[model samples]
Target: MKTVVAVYTGQGLADPLKKVFQELLPDVRLVNIIDDSLIGDVVKAGRIPPGVARRLVQYYRNGEELGADVILNTCSSVGEVADDAGKLIGIPIVKIDQAMAARAAASYERIAVLATLPSTLEPTMRLIEKEAAAAGRAVTLVNGLAAGAFEALNGGRPEEHDRLILETAERVAGEADAIVLAQGSMARMESKLAAATGKPVLSSPRLGVEQVREVLERLSREGEAAR
Candidate 1:
């Protein structure tokens, strides 16, 4: 079985992402490494601190040592770190939001990225911009922050969190060709936001898992060719 190591900075997306893996790559072995405090440290620093980045790199190396065929980074806030780590890591490192961002950038001229935290929102936006530049596509990005929603969710009021996200999506839908949820945790809102706004809503988990499947397939083919 192909082994995948998922590194998470928070617990919010763990179950959802695992479900995706179960559905999409059931034969693959899934291993998780979660450090919930990493998110707090990033938020406090307003960016990924050097120490935090080093720790994340260590986690990637640990995954490699565990014989991971691929490493999945599940935090948009530290996505750039994942990019850098990819250069040093032997196996593929997939940032959870990368495929979603690439799709949004390639398909939409006006994309709105919604997130509860500035830390996630900024990195997600930058990722889309980077993808767009690589594709030679000029895209306009709109930032939508569901202010207080993260706090509400952490406070055990999920309904309020959903409502706030919906409100933010509604407000930005008028100007955006598509909506992208900046965090994997917000994936549950994808279909609802698309239905409510009549727009394409992109989320990370499924797309990221699909990308992982693609990588595994490619690796399999290469292994066969070498034989």
Candidate 2:
């Protein structure tokens, strides 16, 4: 089985993505590269400054020797740097938000982007809109940052996270055709968001696993065809 590597900035995403992928593509190896150091302070401070991207790029470089089949940056704060790393790595490097962005564009013209970190919202929205435009569609990106709720969850209070996410989704309900949760970590609250907004909820981790499955399937077919 081919292995795919995912790098999450300690947002506690590996398990979620791993679980989704295990069900979706059982044969592939899903490896996690966790770095709590880069995203912790920035998310704690409620800002995603420019330096964080460089740090992420450096981290990916150090792990380049692993020869991961696919490299996914699960931290939205470092997507630009993730793109840069993708350019240098010569592999199918995926931004965690990219798959969700593609799905959002395909599903709705007015997409509400929900994120746990304010720093992640803008980038995630931009990525979604960019994907939409590439598909010849115009998208309206709405910000639904639920940092307080996510912080509460990270602090061992899942109820608070659910409350805040539901509350925020209610506020943004009328404005979107579909709700797109920006982080793989944020997908944990999807059920609550869907119930509150009464709309379809798109999650990165779910789409990321879909992306992995498609790519791996293609690779597998190519190998079989060649033989």
Candidate 3:
């Protein structure tokens, strides 16, 4: 069985992504390494400082140590450094947004990246720009921050959190070609966002799993060729 190492910088993603991997590619082995503080520290710092980025390199090295076929970084902020890790690890390092970003870039001329956190906004936009360039397309990014939504979730008001994002998504729907949710925690908004906006809503969970499957298949093909 091929092993996929999921490095999550936040909590609650493991269960959802596990279900995703199972539904998408059942035979592939999945391992999760969660560091909730990784997101918290980055959020507090307003960006990924050098120390935080260094820790992510260690995380990638740890995945390499585990003999992972591919490494999936589940947070967008730290996902900015995934390419740097890919250079060191020699394995496919997939940011959760990569597949989604590619799809959005290919299909949309104007992409609205909706986020509850400021720290998540810039990294996701940068990712989309890189993805658009790779696809030979151009995109205009609309920054939609659901103000107070993150605070509501942290304050133990998930319903309020959902409501805020739903409202924000509706208001911002007409300004872009499609809506892309930036965080795994916001995956729940996919259906709601699509329903309300009647626009394409791209989230990372399923697409990210599909990307892992594709990478594993390529690796398997390479191994067979080598043998």
Show where candidate 2 strays beyond 4 Å.
44-51, 221-227
Superposed on all Cα atoms, the candidates' RMSDs to the truth, in angstroms, are 0.8, 2.3, 1.1
| 180 Cα displacement, candidate 3 (Å) | 0.5
Per-prediction TM-score to the true structure, in the order listed: 0.98, 0.88, 0.97
Per TM-score, the best of the predicted structures is: 1
> Which candidate number maximizes lDDT?
1
Question: TM-score ranking from best to worst?
Answer: 1, 3, 2
lDDT of 3 by residue, 107-159 (tens): 99988899988999888898899989988887999988999998899899999
Worst 10 residues of 3 by lDDT: 77-86
Clashing pairs in 1: none
Could you tell me the lDDT of residue 182 within candidate 3? 90
lDDT string for model 1 (1-227, tens) is 89999999999899999999999999999999999989989988988999889999999999999999999999999999999999999999999999999999999999999999999999999999999999999999998999999889989999999999999999999999999999999998889999999999999999999999999999999999999
The sequence of per-residue lDDT tens digits that candidate 2 reaches over residues 106-208 is 7797888877787788888888878888899888888888758767977899888877878888888799888988777777778877877789998877677
Candidate 2 displacement at residue 125 in angstroms: 0.6
Instruction: Give candidate 3 regions above 4 Å deviation.
Output: none
